[model samples]
Target: MKLYTEEWMKILEHIENNDRDYKLFSINYDSNYWFHAKVKGDEVEISNAKFHENSCSIPNPRKISIKEFSLAFPLYKQYTSGVPGIRYKMQKRKIYNSSYIIALIHEIIDDYYFRFSNILNK
Candidate 1:
């Protein structure tokens, strides 16, 4: 179960239900909760991928459709972090849990999507 509910997920579901070709996002999340994916048809990418912990490593970005993008849990955590909702108490007030991180990321991506969609469709 997710730590919190997201209305954006419902919108994504609606998009998928209405279109097939628009459902091929490419984000790759590993066991550690890090992700790496590039927006299709764009040279830019967004990735906070962890190559190898305790070693010199680099992130590998992959191109995926915008429809395939998704947000997952525990947005950020240390090696031995505590429970989800409870851990928020130990951290700073600016960010609480996966909910806050997801919202922030969603807002950023949504902004970029709106900004580019107008140009791409025209």
Candidate 2:
């Protein structure tokens, strides 16, 4: 999967012209990561944080790089593959559950990338 390519420009242009909020969740073995973006008009703010059970520590907001975006897909796939029966869950729980987070991230990624066919295909 190639990133920072011409296809990426299409995503950037879409973000620039639209007002949307998107978040991507990923997990590597035992650690969880959250990548968030808030776009308004021509302004875009991106930030990320490491997820912990007790708290989520966010670093300073900065522009997201293609490398980060590229790594997210595999991490997301690994997370979903490791979680069993996640797709069958019905009732939403009001607590900290990995399944819930996975489901939410799946929804967000699907919706946000629906506009960019190349992204999801890659």
Candidate 3:
């Protein structure tokens, strides 16, 4: 999850700066919060994860219909610098209970999906 966040930050930075004309795609908290981009017909997966869909190619930038280029956002506060969400709190807690931590994770995951969707649409 931490790695996913780092990769996401990179993707977000790229998009925010309009550094690349490539379309950036990030699906958060779907068992895999991954990042990918396509620039000048070349496809690159920022996350070190296997492709989950049919369009997994490089150089050619596998064609992804608008519908296929979907993204999910977080429902709760993201792992922003201002405030670490419940997940971080749990991880830092020395005596956090498993049940409580799992519940917090679920909340965070839902939030992640919401946030991602909101940002992508905007």
Candidate 4:
């Protein structure tokens, strides 16, 4: 698998330092960022699958399979605060009991800092 770009890594660092509200997303065919975590109690969900950077089509989902979603618990614990405590009453995919979701806050934060840092340096 390709490594994350300097931009991507920078975004991750920002997310680690600051846990403020943020939204991060990429066009289809872009593999600069990814989140390999589980959803349902037993089901694993890998987001940011194959690069799909096309602006016309739907955003690509980077996906990966796992023997058990639970195996990624440590990653989740280190990354996220906790599963969204409140559940939506609308239609939602069934998630693993302990499946951890890595929110993309880090990516956005990193991107933000990278841009801001560049401006300051300039």
Q: Which regions of candidate 3 are displaced past 4 Å? A: 1-57, 70-122
Q: Quote the lDDT for 108 in model 4.
A: 43
Q: Between candidates 2 and 3, which one is better according to lDDT?
A: 2
TM-score of each: 0.20, 0.36, 0.19, 0.22
> Candidate 2: which stretches are off by over 4 Å?
1-7, 23-44, 47-59, 83-122
Write model 2 residue lDDT over 1-122, tens digit each, in one string.
Answer: 54434433444566565554344444435434444445434333554432323323445665444444443433344455556533333122222233323433364444555446547678
Query: What does the lDDT read for residue 101 in candidate 3?
Result: 18
Q: How does model 4 fare in lDDT?
A: 0.33
Model 1 clashing residue pairs (backbone): 25-68
lDDT of 2 at 77: 49
What's model 3's overall lDDT? 0.31
> What's the true lDDT of residue 83 in model 1?
37
Residue-level lDDT of model 1, residues 1-122, one tens digit each, is 33223433443443334321111121233233333323333222334533423321225533322222222333322212333554354244333223323433443334554446547868
lDDT (CA) per prediction: 0.33, 0.42, 0.31, 0.33
Q: Which residue pairs collide, candidate 2?
A: none
lDDT per residue for candidate 4 within 33-69, as digits (tens), equals: 3333323232233443233332222154323223222
Better of 1 and 2 by TM-score: 2
Residue-level error in angstroms, candidate 1, position 117: 24
What TM-score should be assigned to candidate 3? 0.19
